[model samples]
Target: MPSTDSSEAPNEASTDASTAPWDVHRLPRADGKTFLVTGGNAGIGYFVAEQLAATGATVVLGSRDADKADAAAASIRSRVPDARVRQIRLDLADLASLKASAEALRTDRLDAVVHNAGVKFDQPPRRETGDGHEAMFGINHLGHFALTHWLAPLLAAAPEGRVVTTGSFAATSERLDLDDLESSQDYRPDRTYGRSKLAQMLFGFELDRRLRAAGNTVRSVVTHPGGALDSLTPPRPPLHAPTTGERLRGLPAGILVQGKEAAAWSAVRAVLDPSVSGGQLWAPRIFGLRGTPRLRPVRGHLADAEVAARLWSASRDLTGVEPEFGLG
Candidate 1:
């Protein structure tokens, strides 16, 4: 099992063999690899997809909106002239549609999958998914859970497959109520959102444990984009066009927080860095809010085996999809 030590040092191999820090602008070549970035049409996800595409890998943008996905793909192609990008319609809110989405990949092996898509409501009027679970928890946690189950075989076929789950800083202060996984009883928008992300992070950590026990080469890595602000983000035309006023107002916050592009570094690094091991948590270097990506010790409830195991069981029961690891 991976270490749970809070004081553990960052992995020395996190840097390249030349002892130089990992540079996001110049990623190592991944010509033959295929990566999927959920919600790649906008925000940090778009930047993650763009960065990965720069390495000559085929990137699949998983989004419910076809037009947006097309536009995002176009943007990537324009930026990286040789980029190879595809799109697959994925509606996480509807459980029945995911198997088809997984099948749409049209490839036998998937190198890595970045679970960056999520839903967060800012106001009242509690919502539920098509499956009758809370929207936030259902889409953010359960949807990915089921999708992973269907994609297991394709992942296992890879030489060294990876499942990179994008977690959140909001999850750090929250705890999961496994008894009320869906928050059907007491539902506050912010709290529910936090709990949903917390559940996802828990699932990521627990998944690494199960992968190890199953003797699977596929690794599960978790990452969080801390304090990403749209105003701080660079415009991606129709997807994200921040006004000058918005950029001016966001400058002060940029000192501690960062734009979506910077936020993409953690997940991108987690996906591409050869030294990043399963069970490690990658985040920004400066107080985890902004800076270059680096390894952060897995601590607190994230390292709680008992809670993670319970959450894993609850997730399996709720989704009714058992991830097939092939052996143990």
Candidate 2:
């Protein structure tokens, strides 16, 4: 394994921080590294996988749809013919399937695990997943929580392992209800989604603290893809382009929302940038809407230790996937 550990300094010479917030072109070669990206079939996840693969890293795209995964892999290959990439079946909405996918992963030398899969739209008629939790919360927070717990040992095995969880601006105004994470008593789609994102933020920061306390090298980082417009995603042949109406809608969004490719920069930076340490939050430098990605301060409730501890405990109890190394 590589000798890189938490003590090693970042390859600062490779990426000039003064020139830009993050430049994928300046990323150091990841010839022997491996990364896993959930929901890599489309949107920002696909772009993240593509960027990692472009850096000569072995990227494992995780998605529920086998066909879409294959297409995504093929699309990456078409862009970077020599890109090393593969796919695995991972349904974050389904606990059993998610566990099975984690068990099937080749975790002996994983460098980073990017949790990017999520349900953005508020699916009305709030429903619970197979694990008996709210669908959005289950898929967005609980599912990734379980997967990360299961894969913690593997991440620890790597010299500079990282777990990158995608957060959202919505978390800024939302409060996670630990006593009722599933929103059992009351369920509003938007608030439920906001609470779920906040949960993810809490988990990422809490996990980093736990890893540090336990003297582990693994890093848990949180990032947000600011207003990534889906219409601007890379076109995969045979896949229809944005409709006329969608294009028209994208016109205004184009000004406010960054393309999926650019939006992926935050997550990619969190995982690959050696300067980025555990518990750091990275997001857009603009109005939390679109612009260059940069490291941001964790403020207000985001830095609340009591809430984070409660979330960590509640996650372990709910998922039943106790981390092998992160628990202190």
Candidate 3:
């Protein structure tokens, strides 16, 4: 495991999922603030909830499959006796699902929204969601975009709230497909996934800029797991049993960051560390492109201010949901 000494967590303290960084010994409030994590059944998302629930926060799993969600909640409660886990069915590929899930939230004060769910198809195929957006692009980027839009009110109501999105090293290589938002021209397995990740990073930075410009106090933060180091990477192994394929490629990420521990750090820091500013990209420190969660700068042509703005505008047009929260 990476040394906890280097974390920029509150008070420069070590960070564990269950305990706040030295800065925040108390897990955030469980009283009224609510948290929702996408793809919370297994891997990092599950661990995020585990830590949050263990510390006394209410969490809802945004899952596409109800059964998997139920299992996730039961599993968490088994581990953390005071877990407040709820399930909401959401399909990132479906716009209606995004809207429905957003409306399903009964709590008004949404302390945080984590977009951790993602997919990387191993084969090359021209796929689009029912909404006509590219499969990888739609689900990975647009789906979360829409969900964030719907939940803006929940975020705005909080005295101090945040929105965290997960991106990857693949994003540094991805160029904005402004001419073709849906990746219609050509499709390669890994590159297409990279394109989606790139879009995700752009969205995070752009969201922060928009929020700042609109005068909303809500903090917008973006974090990424090292390339192929994240828990939700391809060739997903069984619940407890990891396979040979993942082990070989992810040796660095695994060695640097074990299981959910690796993916959770940057995200946990982004939320708990108040010194962190908006539009900053956080990854691991050493060989971060492959392991641990550390704050690192990623420079790319696609992340150009002009391109980010263009992508944000296009996302609004595509989702038919204007950027209302931070665009005051």
Candidate 4:
């Protein structure tokens, strides 16, 4: 766990999640705001959607499966009777699908877009996308890269637009090389996933720099769900139907891990907290693995400006999505 000492934490404290002791339930009213959450059908993403909807935000769940998305949205409505929520089919593994999804959202003003969809690991031989790129790299980083580009116009048009990409603790421990982003030479599931997440962190920071330089109103922020588990999460059919093995696994993690809802505090804060700014990274307050959300310092490769710029260029080339800044 990372230390929460003021000296160690990054960025100064602004506003708490709510007026009452950093509680997520008391989030500011989001009436009339619209947020799109990728992978909202499951895990931390689903809880993110639920939390936003509870606060009067119009939540759009981006799921690869329409049925699963519908189920998640229905679950949200069931919990929050007045919750305005819907689902859109978005397969992160497919670039074509991502583009189309972005187009579908063109007419909507997106207050925030949470890039939360991701694959934890790839099995032996590794899966590839339609573009023949590694699954984790393509879906986690490249796919979101293109989607954000397509939606840049909509984001910029909003009063306070935000792009919150999900990051991971793996970034601090694992190695990465922007030169070989797809991991053609070195292919391991854990390392590949870590590199992809590092890329995401880089993209978030680089994006902020570009947006600032271009004088754009949109903000780019990054967040990580620290040690969250399904067994600890509220039951949402299709997404959080914990198995026997999963329950067994959760017993120990339940002690060491935070619930998905708790983990989502970082993302929710990133999107809705007026005090939070672009380029900041949010994570658990206690060692970055558990407790309330807080502004955390970014270190190592994730903080390298030159490397981040290079990664940004590589992303643009790989995804073929031109940067949209200061444009109508």
Candidate 5:
């Protein structure tokens, strides 16, 4: 096993705080590392899975749709030639679905788990997932939350155990609803999505705190693809591409990603960057909110230990995925 925990500092030269975060030439991942990416069938999630495979890591694609998962694995193998990516069935919307996925995968080792699958939309009427939670919070946040809690052991077993959950720029828009999580009264799609994202990010902070408190070595970190991203958006979104995506299709402009290929770097860096010291977040660094990926500083709100603990307790109560390492 590798000697360093996820929170440990890397080799001296790798600690260059001055380096830009979003370089396309990704740093090589550790040999024999394994990663599982949720919603790896298409969009940014697919791109992240593809790049990780290209970096010589075995990747497991977790998607709700089995057929789509098969197709996605085929597409990636075609592109990367020797890609070692597999597919697993994981439905975030249903409790039984999530439980079945966990039960089926009895594997005890995973270096990293990236929670990149989520939904964002503008629906006329409100909807809830099979679990009776609001659409955005249920599927986007709770689904992944439950899944991650189940996978915690596999992550902790790895030499540099890490979990990277994807947050959105939307998280910047709204604060969490400690009082009313589901927004049962005022169910606005946009706000719900933002709240869910906030939930995911907050979960990362809480996970880190719990790991530390329990004397566990697992490291928890979060990453966002940026405002204008092709790779990280949900596969089912109506606006998968930027409305003006065609206009931005010219040459590799200054800091923006021209395509999904370029955008996957932000996530790749988060998983493998030896310099990343746990709590620091990663995202693209440029205007139009797309392009140069960097390990930008995250908002302090995420680091609020009080809010993190509250969110953690709420999540466990809601999903019932009892984490092995208890913080309280």
Candidate 6:
């Protein structure tokens, strides 16, 4: 059995002041490393890709649309000048295409993959993916699950590979209905979306456990960008161009919430912070809504080992792909 004790992992409080609070603007250089950011074409994912690219790492923007992905890459290059950015066509909703998408990366080693892509519907008649699963749960959780399985080999090949799963603060209030993983029975927009993110968080923790049990070098860490709003986000030209009026409208909310760029901090820290360990949850420092990314204890259902294990099993059965982490 994998040891459940987390005592051996470095505690955030124990780290020296110099590195305890990470500077999002001045990330550690990752000259030769490569990272993939799913849904990098827009929103928080785009900023994550841009920040990673600034570190001199080859950042790949994984998106369903080639045009959008290319535009995002170009935007990053515009900002970073000499940024080494690439794009791969990735549609998490279509599970059948993920194997080929992973293969298309064509890299021997992948230092990290930030699973940032997700779908949420505010008003819906309830949608399902091509795989006949609920859209939000399908793309948000199972899609990344299958992608991770296919990318396991490349991740295992890295010196200190990391799988950074982007979760959500909304998940805190939600619980998984293990019997109805598809949400076909109790489908509400917010509830279903929260449950999907909860599922992703569970998968992250369980993946870490399995990696430890198998003695794999790869690590899985989970992070959530708390309360990010587009109106507060700075424009990225063709990608995101919030108007002056929009910024003014969002000013009141800015005190409690943050822009998408600020929201990317937790995931960025999870990827680049050497002190961050597997099975940890990172979030914003202020009310978990807006501030610097900080290490936070996994509480409530997020730490429920039994649920995580069951979810892992269910994910395997649903996706038809066992994440062996190269152990097989």
Best by TM-score: 1
Clashes of each: 0, 0, 3, 2, 8, 0
Local distance difference test values of all predictions, in order: 0.89, 0.82, 0.73, 0.83, 0.73, 0.90
Query: Residue 241 CA error for candidate 2 (Å)?
Result: 1.7
**Candidate 2: lDDT over CA atoms?**
0.82
Q: Of 2 and 3, which scores higher on lDDT?
A: 2
Total backbone collisions, model 2: 0
Off by over 4 Å in 2: 1-21, 326-328
lDDT of 1: 0.89
lDDT of 5 at 208: 74
lDDT of 4 by residue, 1-328 (tens): 3754767442444656333444667888899888999999878998999999988989999988888888888888888979999887888777767678977664568899999999867566777898888989999988888888878877887998999989998887865686688988878888899888888888888889888887888999999988887677766665577777777777777666778988888999899888888988889877788877888877777789998878877887887775576632
User: What are the per-residue Cα lDDT tens digits for candidate 5 across 82-143?
Assistant: 78889888888986677667656556788888889988878747788877988888888888
Give the clashing pairs for model 2: none
lDDT of candidate 1 at residue 324, scale 0 to 100: 67
Q: Name model 4 segments beyond 4 Å from true.
A: 8-21, 243-249
How would you order the candidates by lDDT, starting with the best? 6, 1, 4, 2, 5, 3
Give the worst 10-residue stretch by lDDT in candidate 5.
1-10
Candidate 2 lDDT, 1-328, residue by residue in tens: 0122333224322255564435666776789898999999888898899889988999999999999999889989989879999998998877667667876776587899999999865567888888788888889998999888667777888999999999988888899887788889888999999999999999899888888888889988999888877676555565436776776677777777777888898898888877788888878766666766666767789999899989878877888775657464
Model 5 regions more than 4 Å off: 1-13, 16-23, 229-258, 326-328
lDDT tens string, model 3, 1-328? 1234543444233434554433223444455557888888776777666666765678889998888888788878887787888978888999877777987878877888888888888896788889998899899999998889888888888876788888876776567668887778877768889888888888888888888887788887788765433432433223334566655766655554444544566676666555556677776665554444455544556358898888888988899885478475
**Higher-scoring candidate on TM-score, 3 or 6:** 6
How would you encode candidate 1's per-residue C-alpha lDDT over 1-328 as one tens digit per residue?
A: 1333555454734545565668878888899999999899988999999999999999999999999999999999988988999999999888889899999999999999999999999998899998999999999999998898888998999999999998898998898887888888888999999998888888889899999988899999999998899999988888889899999999999998999999999999888888888898988877888888878878888899999889888888888886766843
Better of 2 and 4 by TM-score: 4
Give the Cα RMSD of candidate 1. Answer: 2.6
Q: How many Å off is the CA of 171 in candidate 1? A: 0.4
> Lowest summed-lDDT stretch of 10 residues in model 4?
10-19
